[model samples]
Target: MIINKFGFRSNVKSVSLSVMDCSAGMLSISLFKDLLKVHKNSVALVLSMEVVTPNGYNGKVKSMHMANILFRMGGAAILLSNRKQDKHKAKYKLQNLVRTRLGSDDQAYQSVHQQPDEAGKVGVSLSQELLHVAAKALRTNISELSPLVLPYSEQLQHGWSVIKQKIWFLAGQKGTYVPSFKKAFEHFCTHAGGKAVIDAIEDNLRLHKEDAEASRMTLYRFGKTSSSSLWYGLSYLEAKGRVKKGDRVWKIAFGSGFMCNSAVWKCITNLDPNLRNSWSDRIHLYPVEIPEVCDH
Candidate 1:
């Protein structure tokens, strides 16, 4: 027990929490929500920051250089409370959270790894198998999450497809059906990992180009802000006046553990188009056409 500057004695809970590697933003929110459950009517603040120093990498490996090219300094702070009084002012409600990891597999664990080069200069080396590993992790996460967030009709269709796929496998054929996430979520905020990553998600999830516009714009404008990329994508939607009351959003992210994590949020208030935020000043210039390769 201790007394704070406010002169009130209370228990201060301190936790050294981390999910290991990136995606710490989502991990922090999960932990914060869990802590709130333990302390009723409590408010929790989750702060996530990433600072990429110029000296953090020293290598000529093309894979490693990709990190330096994409990673940048960024941070986000989110406040959450379970207090009934705060409900009226709350912007969204957390509906579901699902985390998946393949760290036990060697390929997954080494997908995004830090090590020394031949010159003994340390830098993060991305494995050539990263995309494959990431896809598996995302699939596993969606399998667990779909039941929780998707509509019953969608789930039934997906289940039937899986059964048909299994039968086809017995016949030495391949078939799969990708469930439509758009039916359940009005907005999709995926991590701005890279253009390839964003494109893969948009294609696999059957999302339209407009649905991935926020993520593509974030990657182009802010680079890869690591754990906070998802928030920036959400902010892009907010600034564009795309979010509305009763809208459901799907926030997804992938990280170093070869992990995929997702959270579902239901909007409680209609957002204002004129809302000032990180993207407000330049929202008009977004959804720009990014050529296959830019040389200018």
Candidate 2:
């Protein structure tokens, strides 16, 4: 249909994927980078979408129940290319992408899975243990990501902080120091899955409220939006003009297969406020106080 509408040749090579729900979006971009790297000057179009139907679930399990409340309708198409000519119009350039999967572990793979119970009823059961699995994956991913994105000075400081914490640990001290990601990134587009997920990231990263305001506002306005929440948060920042040339934004997400995927992008040009986005009409209404519970 895209080719029919856009008048592209019918025989263009294309690939489609299904990579563990929320991870699908970032994984597609990861594949895009590899394709562009090998094919020289080629362009790749990555499309992500999720369809939620009530008929799919009839169980009252925690995960299945939450899914209806969290995930909303979303779809997005991203164009990526290695051609130098396309750089001028690009909003951001990919810097680093890290994908981690804990599928090897039974707990991780089973944390959020569709399974049948005693009466032959199937539902996606979410274990509280899911948080532990996700947090572990997050730490491993960030441990590798920090050095690539953090400035030299910040890296040195973080290293020394780690050394001190280790020394304190050996001295029977009950403490741990987590490096601040804000020192490395100007903006963060955390997956707007839920308030708890956002809060866990903020706490672990040692970020200030101003740093998390975009994510909080994104969650408030858009709910989960699945993997596309990253763009929603980015749009919130772009809508408020927080993103500018040379700024770095991090996109982080977690998926059902107990996957943690992250990508860092450097803004090449200022985001135009007038450019088309979902927040055009009510951006001013955002960065507002989002209550914990919605009362109907």
Candidate 3:
């Protein structure tokens, strides 16, 4: 419909995908790369939209109720091209992408699911095991992604730590080292799914509060915009003038079916500090104190 509305040629191609919410952005980039392989100099539009307002459920189920509190209606779009003329003006260059899925496991598969209730009214369900499943998915994704992004020194440290942790396990010990991804990427665009999600990522990665500021602020301002949440986080970094020329950025997201996807990008040039973005009007008020919310 977009292509038709734009009055594009009939030969222009389009594809729609629904990989849950979080990983859709990276998945769209992967799909665009595949299109480039088949059609040289191809231009692709990656669009992500989530309409959670209609999915809101008023039932008494607590887990299901959280979704209404977390998700919000939002969308984002990006244009990609292999054309020589467009390359000069591109903001960033894709470096690497890694995806992990644990759908084979029953718990992982149903961690975040949509189904009917006792009254046969359907709604999205959030399992108590959702966080556990997300952690597993992230570990699997990092295992595949670390080698592609982390420097050699960090990799050696990470490898030695894993071995030490295994040996410690045999000796009845219970601690493991967390390698610093900050050494690998200058900026991180973690999914702004919710406050809890942001907290978990920061804790697991041993990241400083400033490192997670963009994600936290994005969540506070935008709620959980589903797949587009990562973009908002990245936009936050840009708006703060944190991203620099030649800097590497790590974008990570989690979706239903226990999927974790990551994308690495290198900034092509230094971005203007005053770059207008979604948060232009209120960027000054952000990095604000986000107090803990306990529902007990």
Task: Tell me the TM-score of each prediction against the true structure.
Answer: 0.90, 0.90, 0.93
Report how far off residue 87 is in candidate 3 (Å).
1.6
Q: In every candidate, how many clashes are there?
A: 0, 0, 0
Output the TM-score of candidate 3.
0.93
Q: Tens digit of lDDT per residue, candidate 1, span 1-296?
A: 11344364356564545435468888888888788888998887676767788437766766677667767888776778899999988889998989898989999999998788898888888888988998899889999998887889998887787787678455553556678999889999997888888888988898999999888888888888888888888899999888999999999988887789999999998778787878989899888998889411
- For residues 170-215, what per-residue lDDT tens digits would candidate 2 score against the true structure? 6564454566677778998887777788888888888788888887
Model 3, 12-125: lDDT tens per residue? Answer: 777778645677878889888777878887788888878776677877666667777777877888888888888778899889988888989999999899887787767788
The parts of candidate 1 lying over 4 Å away from their true place are 1-19, 59-62, 168-174, 294-296
| RMSD after CA superposition, every candidate | 3.4, 2.5, 2.2
lDDT of 3 at 111: 87
Q: Model 3, stretches more than 4 Å misplaced? A: 58-62, 166-174, 294-296
